[model samples]
Target: MKTLLLTKEEVDGLICMHEVIGAVEEAYKAFNSDQVVQPDYMGIHLPSPRGEVDFKLGYNKANEVISMKASSGGFIDNPTAHGVPNGMGTILLFDARSCALTCVMDGSLITGLRTGAAGAVSVKALARKNARTVSSMGTGNQARMQIRAINEIMTIEEVRAWDSHPDTLARYKTDIESEFGIPVVTANSKREAVEQADILVTTTRGKGSLVEADWVKAGTHIVAIGTDQQGKQELDPEIFRNAKVVVDSMAQCAEKGETWHPLNKKIIAKDDIHGEIGEILVGKKPGRENDHEVTIFDSTGMAIQDNVAASRIYQNAIDKGVGTFFEFFRS
Candidate 1:
């Protein structure tokens, strides 16, 4: 059998933000229809102050493909010590029918793109039609991708951003303004960013709540992206009290994502959740019924997202002859 090997650059070249958003939206629809088989993510945590590696795997029955991703992060000193980023990931895709390893690709870019696409999907389904201002609480790669994806789906007039590092915030501002021609503003505080936003995004690695409930407006839509692990929080638990909370996966979010804190502390119950984003995508449930309703999308990241995105990229690579193909075994 032959396996296609793709680098991060090659994968990036194969995918555009609009295509990713479409693919991720379909993946969510498939998931809601019970056309996907996904397991909970498993993680191996290193000692405190270090990092952790996580494994996420799933199959899209509709697409007849399976994928597995191994991702690691949380080592703050990686850049200084090893000259590498704080996080890294790789993806493996296989044919379900033949059980053949069809592709091996860098998953770091896929991770960011799909995550951004997930937020875009939520924004499209939940955010108000007049949501012209977007706010982000981090100025990193994920934040950039989130803005890019949102720009593809919605007409964002202004972006308000905040970061602990001033240089990072400035760079994010410059990049967004240059690439998308959208006005970018640097907020002096997180509260200022949240209060001014019609659509709020939290993509930080902080382990505590960065947004308070009172800071959010009634019509706001929040996409929480950073709380994919236990004890990592970005939104206040009280924020879920009167909000229409939609999660990527109920089981996954209940255990690891932003829903965990609220569910754990009895701030909210599972029944309080409106539905998974898939349900909204499939039209089994409604999204953002009224403009005055506060809505929150708790994104924990899903393997099916990776599988669907990788599958799309793999096919694009094949059609464009973008990646290297090598024989791994001979029959």
Candidate 2:
């Protein structure tokens, strides 16, 4: 049998943020309903370049496909040193019945889109219904993707962004304002950005906490990204003491995500976790009970997200005849 192969650009052309968001939402439903098999993700840290490679593998019974995504990022010098983007990855999709490799495609773009979609999913379910302002930390690739995805789910009246690099923040403001036709401004400080947001997104890679607990205001929904690995702290654990914390996967997040720090430090216990995002989506639990309470969605990323996304990409490629096909297993 032949396998389909697609490059990053081809994959990007095949799927968009809106489709991926809907797919991600469906994936979470299957995940909690026991229609998907996903193991906790694994991460390997590199000392030299200060990077991380993460492997997410899963099987979707509904789609009858298995997939694994290998993604790497955080190499600050990659643009100059490797002549490549900082984040890159590939996805291997297989047929469940035959256990044969059916598709090989670029995963980096999917990774960014799925992640951005995940944040939007959380906002749709957990954030305030009237949220019109979004504040974010770290204006990079994922930041752009998140803003694009969130705009699809809600009407963002304005966007405030903060980055340690003034030039980066300025560039992000310009690019966002130009592309989305929205008011984009640079925040003078992290507190100024976050406190003003009905939804606060953190996408930094700093080893220490970036957003203080007190900086967060009531009714604000925080999406904690960039904490998929151990020791990556973006929000103060004290926030957990007051905010209703929901995670993509409790088993994964307790050890490797934003929830890990608070659990280890005794700031909050496992039982304090409100529920999985899937549970909220499937109506097993409630979302944002009151407008006055704060909420936190700790997104460590999910294998189910990768599985559903890859499956959709493969099907779309086949339908559109968009990629190269080769019989790599031919005798």
Candidate 1 Cα misplacement greater than 4 A, ranges:
none
Deviation from native of the Cα of residue 61 in model 2, angstroms: 1.0
The alpha-carbon lDDT assigned to residue 94 of candidate 1 equals 95
Task: Give Cα-based local distance difference scores for all models.
Answer: 0.94, 0.91
Q: Against the true structure, candidate 2 has what lDDT? A: 0.91
The worst-scoring run of ten residues by lDDT in candidate 1 lies at 41-50
Candidate RMSDs in Å, in order, are 1.3, 1.2
Candidate 2: stretches off by over 4 Å: none
Error of 1 at 137 (Å): 0.7
How many residue pairs collide in each prediction?
A: 0, 0
lDDT of 1 by residue, 145-263 (tens): 99999998889999999999999999999999999999999999989999999999999987898999999998999999999889799999999999999999999999999999988
lDDT of 2 at 155: 99
Candidate 1: residue pairs that collide: none
